[model samples]
Target: MRTTRRWWVPAVAVAVIAAVLPVTPATAQPVSAGPGPVVADGVTQPVFGYADAIRERIFVTSDVDTDADGALDVVAMDIIRPRASEQGLRVPVVMDASPYFSTVCRGNDSECKADLDGDGLNDRWPLFYDNYFVPRGYAVILLDMIGTNNSTGCPVTGGRADNISAPTGIDWLNGRRKGVDAEGNEVVADWHNGRTGMIGKSYDGTLANAAAATGVDGLTTIVPISAISNWYDYSRSNGLVTRANNYSGSLANNVTNPDRRQYCAPVRTQLGQGGDDATGDYNDFWAERDYLPHAGQVKASVFVVHGINDDNVRADHFSKWWYALAEQNVTRKLWLTGTGHIDPFDFRRAEWVRTLHRWFDFWLHGIDNGIMREPAVDVERLPDVWETHADWPLPGSRPTQVFLRPGTDGGPGGLSVRSGPGNRSATFRDTPTMSQATAIRHPSDSSANTENRLVFLSAPLTAPLHISGTPIVRIKASVDGTDTSFAGLLVDYGTRERFSTSGDGIQTRSTEDCWGEAATFGGYAEEGCYRQTVKTVASNPQELVTKGVVDGLNLDSLFVSTPLVPGAKYGVDVPLMPEDYVFETGHQIGVVLLGSYSGYSSRAKQTRSQITVHFDSTRITLPVVGGRQAAVAAGLG
Candidate 1:
């Protein structure tokens, strides 16, 4: 074991928007078309040489000292830029800040930061940013999240140390801060063209969100893939402890450099205590990690990406963040892929690179690319099918309401558009022993349903059913105890192929697709390239579209808990993640109610108290295309 748990790393998006006009470069240096990138055909040309691109390391001091060590912590910034930067040519930057540079890796290929020649410097940058973008006049920087790798400080999960560390690189680039070489000699980013773009997946992406939320100057754009906007949402669901207690601390300790682990032990203790898993209430700790509150301050143009099938980070992270950015009317674009926690570089490949290139050029290089003029999103409906939508919630989309009706003697219920067969109630006891996999397994089979879960299925759809945007499920139920947990799952029942989680949908060929600057170690290929995933036929009868869970007492307030009156009816809301799916003809939409869900959150504890569903008014609101009429026409009734 290199360290603890499944070590994570970072993702990089879809669609190419052709430039609206070919203009002179006007990015960092304010010269024509700016810096040294050769512009042709509305995009930056790869005319710069990758072999001699200047590669070096520097330490950018951060504003935080999590350990109370008096001195500010310094983050490790590894750089690889076009050699033109060393001369009079300046360039914009694309940076990814991640903790996995030390212990974990990224993507399906398990790629990590490497020192190919062991020169104590990163020779082989993870992914293809350095290999592909360095030659295109973009300085690709990989920052070692403070407290990990060669950076100084303690990893505080998403606290100031983690959230505020990486942006120092931006600060240095913009002349807001000064960096130093290994020997402590002052180093200034005089070569930096003022504009910068941050890109990453998972925790790496979370940092980008944090950086943008700060409204930091010079950070003109960000491409956050499968990222988090709120730390509390990552650990809890509707004020219920879904992840294990002390997860914040555990994760902090997991990513910290081994040498400094002991020094940061106290900080880890505080992080765990601050999470307040016992009550699972939002507190100062989670507030510090949340970026949404600061969304109003963001000035960067966001190019956000998320995996619709991703269960690890979940789709809610993107949905909430998207809405927040939208409310602020911030310039933004989105990409929803069918892959689970996978990068577009691996899933979409060439298109991702091209669109990302255009996005950086548009935002960072001040290019007149019509990327913003293009559809706001490129959404993947299937492995081979992608659609470009003008924006989220395709036009005429609205929340369609659906209700649960009684079944034949506790077998399974039917979902109906007609409401108020009122006063009819369905009941089920809490089954803590049932795993989430078993609870939601194969909804088409009646054997999968028991007293542990209440399954409701809609009629076969006569027309196509398209669901986009966030869906909300509110349960009108009563429980036996003062507090209990509930789970609601939205299911798609039909035979179709979807993104496979267990690699059954992909086959590794003997031939490998090589990439990067072609640097190799003693025997290993350190060019950040490998032959990984390929699409294969994968099908299933039923798939989990989304799920939401909540604690009864915390439904109204995540920061406070209210004990329930025995056998009293109350509306318990389960915040389902966002989704973009199209249910074909003959497919049925299903909803499952459970006492808890281990499938969604592995550590979610089951509520042992009995729970009941009052069929009178409980309903789920789906963002279905064409609203109620389309839902009725599609058999969503």
Candidate 2:
């Protein structure tokens, strides 16, 4: 794939405040207001777009009872339905509470609650709701879930135990005369009408996941974007406890200061943070109420999307659900890019809108538009390259392993795989080499505690190997201290620069169940622990760090995820942590020996902790492909 360089232009996040000015007695709560011919404003804004025609004024009905008392004695909503068509009917609904009425919507910035787009019309709730749900030719239903703005009651973001509002929303639609189906059936009149699909980003995405998990009647499809599926993984990656960035405790601060305590109280209760409780596991109360468990049970199809470089929620979430869905044999699609959390600025907004319209048309309209038949995975690699794979990891990739070995020459000595378990180790001088830009360990050396790295190489491959999938690095190691940390890096030896070809998807292969589904290529048979899938070999240099971890006197194997390239020679480099460590007088640094890839390196960057790993037995695990093995499987010569 050819890479192109494009400057990233992030959209400015404008804070929109609500228009909470007191209504004059002259133009108070309306009795009857006709649909007006509202003209567009001259100003153009970043997020707000122009529509061919605006439904100007909606004569919505509303009720309000001012009190902190636990009584939702109010109702308000605008009706926006598509004109009945000769072919099919479409309906959509949008909802938001306070900000649409009061100035403090979503905690900060009253402008966000007003006419955010500067369209000369207030659409705080309208546009935000339609951004995700209302496609062309669909009837729209907007509800004041808790009846905040013009309505009354506790506006449920998605729903509540006592008030499963999402299904209630569907109920409202089917009850409308215009929403009835062919058999003279009021679509929303019955609770058993077809399921309702909920879609949105950020707050809306989380609610969709919650509604889907609740298994509410008439709740069919929910598309949760940039949301946390497993609360534990969301708070903890691998097994390490992460800073509580996405939880209620961190977010409650944003709500409290603004006196939006109305929204805060219910959200905190739902998160279980206010009740001296812990919402920890995937099986816990919060997850039960919100988490979409088995991908197989997703009765409603989901088009999961996420930004790879999201500082808020992280893109690892996409991997979690994508693998789960694949395991459940469910067909789902993913759109992954390197962008900020709130806005997917990776692609133009129009492209995103078009894709969603096509998706909604196929599933909601029953148009047989063949959108579902598209590729399962679409990824945007860095620099710039958008690719579509029939399936993740692409197809026809073969497995090839490059052993990490100690070497006297700058090049890593080529190591080979054996029929049974085997081990080897090598040592290199502690000194800095190569440009600082490509160095794995920083600050080269500190005091007499010298730090050094090794570079091992693999013999050139004879064939054009396709290595588009994931590969594993196995290293057996032991350390001299009570604690140690190991890290791995794959490098290309053919080019003088020793660049790394390990792309976005390549990762350390620990348990085979990494992908869950059994891949036909990799000779490594499937097991319950398998979690990921790897592809074949390419014609570039390759290398892998078999292990990187910190522990005492442990004989374990580590797996490093690094793909390989054919023809060009490959190599491995393992640097002692002291090379990157700042030795504090009393603290001692020790190299850790390992046989497997460690998650220690992954979190070390986040936690800013020092770690070192010493390697003892390092070997390569190659999936035998095409030779005798392929012939035996296919009965070919």
Candidate 3:
């Protein structure tokens, strides 16, 4: 690493360069050196050459030992900006602090290789931010987050150390924190205006959410796509463990320095102990990582984008975060899609880039782009169509509870408003080996009539039924065992083909699609093209809408567990996955109840105990457009 002091270029030299440079859509006009700011049109600007305008360096953070070592950690920072910045033109910063730079790469690439050039910098930068934003008068910084790549320390997953590390970088840019280069020399950021915006996908985006939640002074806004708001929710649900392995310790070890893994053994042990897989209850460790609790501290505007059908992070994360931000009156916008675990770059390239440009300009550059005046929510209704609303769940939508009733004869149950016989009940044996697909299949299927699950169906809809928010399943049930896992699925039963947002649906290809102003550099592959079609392999007759799970011991609270007493009935409310979807006319809405879901949780020993649900006391509440009237018109009331 190398260090340098603040340096400035002569005003006269910049003026001469501006006079000779050409002005075109494909090339940036030279900016004159002056004390005042020069605003570049974010929509149209040339792609600046990386070699001419970019500089790479390392910034050793102030005294905060993430690895429990005596010394502080160093973060790798790579910057790209307009060359005119050296001539006194200050600009706002757009940053992405990520750990994947070394472990998994940023975009479609599966693995990231450490291909360093002679200058001790990565030859290829991840993502399109550097390729597109530098010419538009924004400083783009690619930081190898605190414990990965060239940064010194051990990764702690989403612990307090990891949650606060990225925000410290914002403090450094605002001149509040001290930083130095790799050679034990002082380094300073003299060119930035101290206003920053962060953006990324998945874990990279989670860092942005965490940093913004800190209420860091200079952070203007954040864009978190398919990001996690709580680590415990990502790995567990209501006392039910989703993963068998210890994720916190495993991920920490994966991102730590190869040679220093043994040195961080104690930290890994601490992570495993804090996770507490046996109970899966919320603790201080998860609370520190829960950004929702800290939303009140956020001053930065939030622009959220998430796939409604994303099972990995789940829509609950974004929905809960959005509601919390609303309570704090934080500026916010949302784009909900029908895709899963995907970035907007791959889902809708051209529109996303244009929207993002305007968003950054309005928040970071003080440009009135009318982005704030527009509708607050834009949701994908189907495969490629979109609908804009004043806010999420629509203004007129109401929560309507649809009751579950036993079949007239010896058939499956029905979803209706009328109550069934008081003595009617459905029983199923706890089977930990049943897959989600088998559990939710239509009751007519011979394979679905097993003793492991109970299926209920609604009559064919007379009109289209649209639901736009989280659905809750309220049930009165008794079990023979002390504790058992409960899984509930809301499904659509029809023959029409739909976008496959589930993980098992699609097989992406090696093809690409071109968008935006074309770039002719590096074989025309820089920011010009992305995957054309997120290929869909449709399922016939039935498709899963959303699912939820809970442990009987957690019926009262997620933070505390109380084992159920055998033969005692309990009323439990299980929140199904949040969704924005429409069931076409003639299609039926179905609900499936199972004892356990092997896909989302570890396979426990077979309980072989009977679980009985009282039909008259069980119901599901959905967010419908016109409440019971709409449901009645659709033959569901």
How high is the lDDT of residue 271 in model 2?
48
Please report how far candidate 2 places residue 279 from its true position, in Å.
Answer: 14
> Candidate 2: what lDDT?
0.36
| Whole-model lDDT, model 1 | 0.78
- Candidate 1 local lDDT, 1-637, one digit each (tens): 0111111111111112113211212222433333467888888888777777777799988888878899988888898888777766777889999988877776566677767667766755677788778778888999999888888888888987777776788777766677788888977776776777899999999999999988877777889999999999898878877787799889888888777889899998998888987788999989999999999999777888988777788788998898888777777788888777777776777788889988888776767666656777788888858998777756667888877777765567787677858878877777767775676666645554556788888888899989887788878999887767788888888889877766523456556665546544334554646665676556888887888888777867888988889899898777788888888899888898987656756656555787878988888888888889988888755
- On TM-score, the candidate that comes out on top is 1
Identify the superior model by TM-score, candidate 1 or candidate 2.
Answer: 1
The local distance difference test score of each candidate is 0.78, 0.36, 0.74
Per-residue accuracy of model 3 over 229-321 as CA lDDT, tens digit each: 888888888778787667888888887767778987788888888888878888887888788999999877788999887878888989888
TM-score of each: 0.91, 0.53, 0.89
Q: Model 1, 408: alpha-carbon shift in Å?
A: 3.0
Q: lDDT by residue for model 2 over 1-637, one digit each (tens)?
A: 1111111111220111001111111211223322211112311111211231122222221222223455533333343332231112222233322213342343111223233454433444323333333323343344333434433343322224213334344434434212322233422322111335566555546555554554444444455667656554444332222344334444433423344455556555544442122212223333333354645555555667765545456555555565565665544666765343533322324455556655554444333444555676566543234667565434433444333444333333334332222333443221222222233232113221222344333344333222233233444432222322234443323312211233322333343221111211122221112223232123322222112222111122111112222222222333211100011222111122222222322223222112222234454332233323431232111
Compare the candidates by lDDT and give the number of the best one: 1
Please report how far candidate 3 places residue 365 from its true position, in Å: 1.3
**Residue 559 lDDT, candidate 3, scale 0-100:** 88
Q: Tell me how many clashing residue pairs each candidate has.
A: 6, 81, 0
Ranking by TM-score: 1, 3, 2
